[model samples]
Target: MNTYTRTHLAFSMLLSIAGLSLPLGAQAADRMAGKMDTDGDGKVSAAEHAVAAKAMFERMDADKDGYVTAAEMDASHAAMKKDGQATDSPMSSADKIKAVDRDGDGKISATEHEAGSKSMFGKMDGDMDGYVTAAEMEAGHKATMGGKK
Candidate 1:
């Protein structure tokens, strides 16, 4: 299996730091939605996304200088580890885009993102239920990692 290199670290950090790289899956995207979506709606609107983005930026911009340097990111991630909130590195940007770019257009449009999520949801929803429980989440991740699709 291929692993993420150090170069991909910046991409992963940026995603976690700014919450811009919302996952293609609805569940993954909404993993933080409980804290992000102030409303009880299952979907995150543009406004809610904006608020989450601002909060992520603020968290990383600890110095409040409007600039998040590499050192700052390291510091913030270190803090996250101390708080036991840290996790493994993400797939490389190229691989991630390829996984979702079914049209092979090299660019994922809004439609493609939604479609990819739907497809993944179908594969993960083993019980054929509308919702995917935590068990299904692990199974989905494993299947995805194992190149099920």
Candidate 2:
């Protein structure tokens, strides 16, 4: 390749890696949490929450197929609802698609789940402090529930 082309390709590659570094770093940080605040720091980082979110997704997947199908979603909802643990708040299957299916292929990828987890981290980590404390979580919960805090 010509020098110009080589430089352009190199730059593009760098940008791609750079773009992924943040989220991947966040995921790594989450893995370090080893079950959310295993170190007892009195705060939860976005990475930690992302880890938890992934676990939750795995549970809802049920079939261990890495994707939560509509049938799986319904079963998950039914199980939770039957136990009165659903809070009537789980997203519908279509809503799940719109929220987490970034590829628009009607399937939620691992990357999409991680992205959703990162987004939830933003909401749960109120005050934008890069960490969530109990108070922040409570406040965020109230806000989400449309209850004044």
RMSD of each: 9.6, 13.0
**Per-prediction TM-score to the true structure, in the order listed:** 0.45, 0.62
Report the lDDT tens digits of candidate 1 across residue range 1-149.
Answer: 23343223322333444332333244554465455557766544445544655555567667876544445555766676577555433544345445444466654344444444444445545787555444554454544334221
Q: Model 1: how far is 125 from its true place, Å? A: 20
The reply for model 2, stretches above 4 Å from the true place, is 1-36
lDDT of 2 by residue, 64-107 (tens): 87876656666766675587433343234555444456577776
Q: How many backbone clashes does candidate 2 have?
A: 0
Q: How many residue pairs clash in each candidate?
A: 0, 0
Error of 2 at 117 (Å): 0.7
The runs of at least 3 residues in candidate 1 whose Cα sits more than 4 Å from the true structure, single-residue gaps closed, are 1-14, 18-30, 90-149
**Model 1 lowest lDDT segment of ten:** 5-14
- Lowest summed lDDT across 10 adjacent residues in model 2 is found at 13-22
Return the TM-score for candidate 2, rounded to 2 decimals.
0.62
Instruction: Find the candidate with the highest lDDT and give its number.
Output: 2
